[model samples]
Target chain A: MSMNDLIATIKKVLEEVDVVLGWTRSPAAGVAVPARFHTPDEADGAIFDSTCTHNLAVHLPRLKNSKVGIVAKGCDARSIVQLIVEGEVSRDRIRVIGVPCPGVIDVKRAWRCFGFGKKIEDAGGRVHMEGRSMPREEILLHKCHQCQDQEPVIMDLAAGDVKSVTPPPPPDKTGIRERFAAMSIAERREFWREQFSRCIRCYACREACPLCFCRDACSMQTREPHWTGGQVNAIESEMAQQVRTSHLAGRCTGCEECERACPVGIPLMLLLEEQNRIVEELFAYRAGMSLEDKTPLLTYDVNRDGGWR
Target chain B: MPKTEVKIIGFLCNWCSYAGADMAGTARMKQPASLRVVRLPCTGRVNPLLVLKAFREGADGVLVSGCHPGDCHYNEGNYYARRRMEVLERMLPALGIDPARFHYTWVSASEGAKWADVVNEFTRRVKQVI
Candidate 1:
């Protein structure tokens, strides 16, 4: 939908909720950045576009005490629904203003190609920045290219015609996915060692995750059990990520926030995506698809689950 | 330098696998000396992290044994453990650990000989991979 429709919907929702979580144009970044609009007047600046990539639902659990309104794109809605499924936020406590997502682009890639602080726009299925244009397909976030949920899974209000959004093109399998598949198990271990060694132990991936709502009790940094150490070496970093990945086994919605937030650029989604696929294949479940859905790991089938053995 | 022998960590449920392992020990069944056993209250208590921690601490392999399905001391602990273990086992290869380095199985308190077989076979498989 258009920016006017997005802002109007946020404005309408702001009347009832404590704050409307949406995006606003950032002059410094030359793209949309997440903003909280507490009043209808503030909603005038709320915008949603291809550059609006943050999943605002990450704020829901932290704001559990407040009646919040969120502007969710299709993938973000999956996270919202998954959060609801996990009972992180009560259904009535939040209002989801669903935007028919036109697929968000990788702002980092855009900034790399067009230069930073240059106004970026998406029109006619092409991204334009500094008078240069690239095909929209070239810069769409990796998650968006494989997006199966163009329609929000749940919403209290629709910002635009949900059906107007088209499906993403089939994923190109030649890059990281192919490389990962090509690597043998031994090679993968070495690959992860080298990749994780570059990690600065910033924990940005955990912070950006919408499902990692465990706040102070997160085992990633806990010393009582000492799941991972504070050392910044590859082993400790890998173990820290192992804790995060295992915790997210049946729950991660493949939002790709962790990868985006990771300053060191660890391909964290490769692990999460593989786990999500395995969970789907083994249990016939996808996290956050429905409110009534049970988490695959929390439940079991007495007579059925044996192929992994 | 060449490694001398494989080190395998075994997490055995207290009610069954642990007792079965005790039975194996009392019976003097000859099995690989590679496994170091840690007993927990139930298979459900065997968090996948413990296994990962064993691996990270330089254990060559990890094994989890519990009561047979529908026969857990806590009624359904192994049922839940089954799913978690399966997910973790499948995840090992993706994490770059050889999936064969990890295993999970059922062993009842009465099945002492069976426990010997389980340990011997698993230890053998781990030795081959290492």
Candidate 2:
């Protein structure tokens, strides 16, 4: 669906809710920002395009009590389903306007295609910056390349028909899981140690995550019986990562925003991918699979689940 | 390698497994000295972080023992522990930590011989892993 059509749908959705959450054209060239529209006039300003990288449902929790409408991509809509399953929000309070996502633009790769600079127009598509056109191959995020859901599983209205495009052949399966499996145990440990050592204890990863609603009381910042010390080193960083990833065991939707937000480019998604696999293997559970499916980590079955052995 | 000593952290529930270990001592049952037991009120209290800390502190193995299914003194702590440890153990290998280094079992207060056997066997596995 084009940006104009998306705004038209959102404008209709705005009549039923106080505000809607969706991507708006950013001041930054070749980017989209999460925008909140309280009125239909403001709704017209929202844009849907390749650069709408954010999972806008991340804003829903803050506006949970309000009747908030959201322009959810496949992933964003799934996140909302997971949130409802976890009892974070009720379905009645929030409205969903599912939009067809052709795949969002990866900002880092887009910069490379734009030769580190670009210009912006609120209208979607074709990063119009100084006669520089970002090749389609370079702009789509890796998640988009492997995107399983082009159309949202759940939605109240669609702006227009979802684009029917064959997802490119699955990329060479050089994902971290296969790579880590090939490495020796000691080598794997050394690899993660080096990657985590580069973390400056920045909380960007935590901030970008849509599911982590811990807010000011997050364990990372606790003092009494602190979860992790303020020390800026590998062990502490590793500990923080472990606690977070484990907490998200069956809840992470594999959004990859944590890795995207990490300033140091730590391979955080690799850890989460491995974790999601374990959840699937052990509990036959996948995050955002269904609204009726309870999170496995929070509940256990006696007959189906026993000891790890 | 001159028989590098294997260190194992044993987290025992106060009601059943800890008493089971004590009975092993009173019965003069010999067990490996490799175990460093930390008694908690219930297996449910055994935080995954504690096991991670044990590994970080150079424990070659970690063992958690509690009441049998349907026999937890706190009614369902061991049941909860079973699931938690299962998830944690499955995830350990992803961090390059050998899943063999962690073990969980049910031990009743009357099972003194079983307590000795669990320790000896776990010590052997840790020795092999380290």
- Which candidate gets the maximum TM-score versus the true structure? 1
A103-187 in candidate 1: lDDT tens per residue?
9888887888878788999888899997899988788888988898888899899988987887796675439888998999999
List clashing residue pairs in candidate 2: A50-A105
The true-versus-predicted C-alpha distance at residue A62 of model 1, in Å, is 1.4
Off by over 4 Å in 2: A119-139, A162-165, A172-177
Q: Each predicted complex: what DockQ?
A: 0.81, 0.62
- The stretch of ten residues in a row with the least summed lDDT in candidate 1 chain B is B1-10
Residue-by-residue lDDT tens digits, candidate 1, B1-130: 4245889999999999999999999999988898999999999998999999999999999999999999999998998999999889989988999999899999999888999999888888887888
What is candidate 1's CA lDDT for residue A212?
94
- Residues B24-130 of candidate 2: C-alpha lDDT, one tens digit per residue: 99999999889999999999898887888778767889999999878989887877788778878877877878888899999999999999999998888877767
**A259 in model 2: Cα distance from truth in Å?**
1.0
Q: After superposition, how far is residue A240 of candidate 2 from its true place, in Å?
A: 0.6
Q: How high is the lDDT of residue A143 in model 1?
A: 94
